[model samples]
Target: MKRIVITGTSRGIGFEMVQLFAQQDCEILALSRNPKPVQELNLSNVTALPFDLASTKDLENVESFLKENWSSVDILINNAGKLVNKPFTEITAEELFSVYQTNAVGTFQLTQKVVPMMKSDGHVVSISTMGGVQGSLKFPGLSAYSSSKAAIITLTELLAEEYKESGPSFNVLALGAVKTEMLAEAFPGYEPPTTAREMASYIANFAQTGAQFYNGKLLQVSNSTP
Candidate 1:
């Protein structure tokens, strides 16, 4: 069975992705701040680990946890993230740091820890935002969140190249607005965005194939009918 590690499994896209992978019979190391209450999803192959990514100490714990449990992981999905809606001028230093700490620093630190445990030919999928791309939109009061996502895009590209010859791989999924907590915070009263299941399915497909073409690439997902 393919072993996979996914962050942020408590809710949103991360939860959906964990469910999808579990359905596919993958060995899952699911990370969340809180334990899920779904008895149906409770399975032998699934192991849920709880840790607040915001804590620097937690990063060290993550490294130790993986080493102690699974000797290797087949895929590492950086799905856990934070979002804050504050105007650029109104954003405080603490708020900005909090966002970056969770969305970028925390994600990178986890990746660094798990990368070594990834099996040969494994893949790393980093969940990013379309807002990271230039011209995506400078949504008012979302400067901090948007800029942090942009940094994730850069991190993905650089890591992909750095580990180009390594067995494990890397890619960034620059997802559009999804009906996630992050989106709700940014666009209150807006209609529901794309469902987590849809995004999860697309990510699952990418993970199964090990498609190197997407390596180091920023993939965008939209709800526009083709």
Candidate 2:
């Protein structure tokens, strides 16, 4: 069985991914801020780790735990993120920092810690946003959110290059506007968007074959695949 580790598994895309992978008979090590209900999923191979991503120090503990338990991870999915809808001028420095803390720094740190623990031919999927792509608009007050995600995209590209000869491969998925609570919170009056289940399936399929097509490329959900 393939061993995988994913972050932000409490809700939205993260939750759906945990469910989908469990069905595929993969062993999952999922992380989230909340501890409750993850146990309710009742998958024998599922382990939900509760911790705040903002705490960079927590990554050390996470790494220690993984080292003590699992031998190596076949897949590492960086799915945790944070978004704020304040206008560029209205958003405080702290708010902007918060966005980067979870979306970029947390991902960077977690990925850094996991790279050495990955098995040969392993894969890493960084969940990004279409908003990160060039020409992707910044409606009203999404400057911080867009910028942070953009940073993640660049980080993904850099990883692809830095680890080219390494055993594992890296890719970034620039997801289109998905119908998750994050979308609802960002655009409250907007109509329903893509379902988490569909996105989850897409991500699962991508995890399986995406590295073959995109090593450093950005795979936009709407245009890259169906």
Candidate 3:
């Protein structure tokens, strides 16, 4: 069975991913700020871990858990993210830092810790936003969120090159607006064309197979034009 590690498994796309991967018979290491949602799923193959990606203590907990339970990971999904929707003029440094802490720094630190435990041919997939793409349609009030996701995109590319000969592959999935709590908060009442479950299905399949054929690419997953 494949050993998969995923962050932000508390709700939204992360929660849906847990459901999809569980059905596929993969052993799941699910991390989230609150473990309740993942635990409630009650899949025997799933291990629910509570860790706030922005907190160093929590990140350390994740590292310790991996050390105790698993020797290597086949797939690592960095899906935890924070979105701060504020006008660029009013955005505070703290707000931008918070988003970066979860979306970029946390991912970098966790990936570094997990790489040593990744099997040869292991895959690292990070969920980025279409807003992060340089030429994609830009939206107001997402300055901090988009920039942080952009950092993940760049980081993934650099890591892919750094690890090219080591066997593990790194890729970014630049997702379009998906109907989730985060989107609702970012753009209230606006319905997105894609749903969390749909994105989860696509991401789960890619996590399992895409690395074999693609690396260091920011593949966009969306049906809507933008």
lDDT of 1 by residue, 118-168 (tens): 765889988887777777755778788878888988998898888888657
C-alpha lDDT of residue 187 in model 3: 81
Model 2 per-residue lDDT tens digits across residues 86-199: 767899989989999999988998998888988658889999887788886547677888788899888988988988887578888888777788988888866555788889
Backbone clash pairs for candidate 1 read 121-167
Model 2: residues with Cα > 4 Å off, grouped in runs: 223-226
Model 1 residue 224 lDDT score: 38
In the range 30-102, model 3's lDDT, one tens digit per residue, is 9988999999878999999888877788778878988999878999999999999888999898998899999
Q: After superposition, how far is residue 122 of candidate 2 from its true place, in Å?
A: 1.0
Residue 220 CA displacement from its true place in model 3, Å = 1.2
- Model 3 scores worst on lDDT over the 10 consecutive residues at 217-226
Query: lDDT per prediction?
Result: 0.79, 0.83, 0.91
lDDT, model 3 = 0.91
Clashes of 2: 0
What does the lDDT read for residue 204 in candidate 3?
96
For lDDT, the strongest prediction is 3
Predicted structure 1, TM vs. truth:
0.92
